[model samples]
Target: MASVTSAESGRLGTLPLGYYSCSEPGDAGGQAWIDLPDKHFTIGNGSTYHTDAGSGTYLLTGKRVIFTRGPMKGVRFERSGKVTLRWIDEDGKPGRVRCVRQASSV
Candidate 1:
């Protein structure tokens, strides 16, 4: 079990540090750059090349990551791989935006 505040330090371990973009479920999902250990994250739209949109803090719970601050607060995502996550968009909706991790250089 892991505490919600420091989930990555416990059972979930470290999250892949870098950027993740959602291209499968259309443009609404956008992209995000996650910096672990620090728990800071940034979100941006496609046209902006993910330069900036909003910033926030996040926490991991089991296989899911919860955005805790900023405009994306309450957003939830579940890990699909070491570097992939599926964003759960809209409450009670049954689709997910596939966000793939990219090299930090991007």
Candidate 2:
């Protein structure tokens, strides 16, 4: 496995998948607070993706995000931000991200 480095500086609060999300639904409590306290913004649904990397399927959800991944490399992610999937040139590492409540994809 490769070392997972920070894609950017100041990008904080990393967590494992089940820390907040429930892929099977119903089990999802309001722990959505995982994506709280974000700055203003919108998302690009055109770029949202949901790939299976074995560890878990990450959901982008169309907004600013903070993600926690597995201890392995060559992983994949999913987009669940729900906005227009228009992914900007991610200055941050293309890891996990959560969107704020402004109807935007971070």
Candidate 3:
């Protein structure tokens, strides 16, 4: 696999790099968090009972970003803002999320 070296590349237009939280309505238990950087990606939850860790390789095409490997393979993500992304699961469920450039220090 080719390592991501540049934050600004040819295909991926402009992607946010930071922490994102699930913001779908009625999703009170949606503790999922997704972190995307210049290179790889990480997905997890900080909930007390949910112990899960995930990582994957992803690439951007037009308005959609596809996870090519790992747990979220085939998931499609679209930019909602510089610090936000909305995505649909492989099962076709829709969701929206907001992110901050910085992670929580707590």
> TM-score per candidate, in order?
0.57, 0.19, 0.49
Residue 92 shift from truth in candidate 1, angstroms: 5.2
Q: Which should have the higher lDDT, number 1 or number 3?
A: 1
Best by lDDT: 1
User: What's model 3's lDDT at 85?
Assistant: 57
Rank all candidate structures by their lDDT, best first, as comma-separated numbers. 1, 3, 2
Q: 54-91, model 2: which lDDT tens digit per residue?
A: 23222332233322333212222333353212222245
True-vs-predicted CA distance for residue 27, candidate 1, Å: 14
Error of 2 at 23 (Å): 22
Ordered by TM-score, highest first, the candidates read 1, 3, 2
Candidate 2 overall lDDT versus native: 0.29
Q: Candidate 3, after superposition: displacement of residue 64 in Å?
A: 1.0
lDDT of 1 by residue, 3-103 (tens): 53443344533456566655443344653433332222333332112225556666665677667676567767777778777767677232445666666
Worst 10 residues of 2 by lDDT: 16-25
Which digits, one per residue and each the tens of the lDDT, describe model 3 over residues 1-106?
9884442233654344434444333335754544443322333332111113556566665556666666656666665556555666566554543333344222
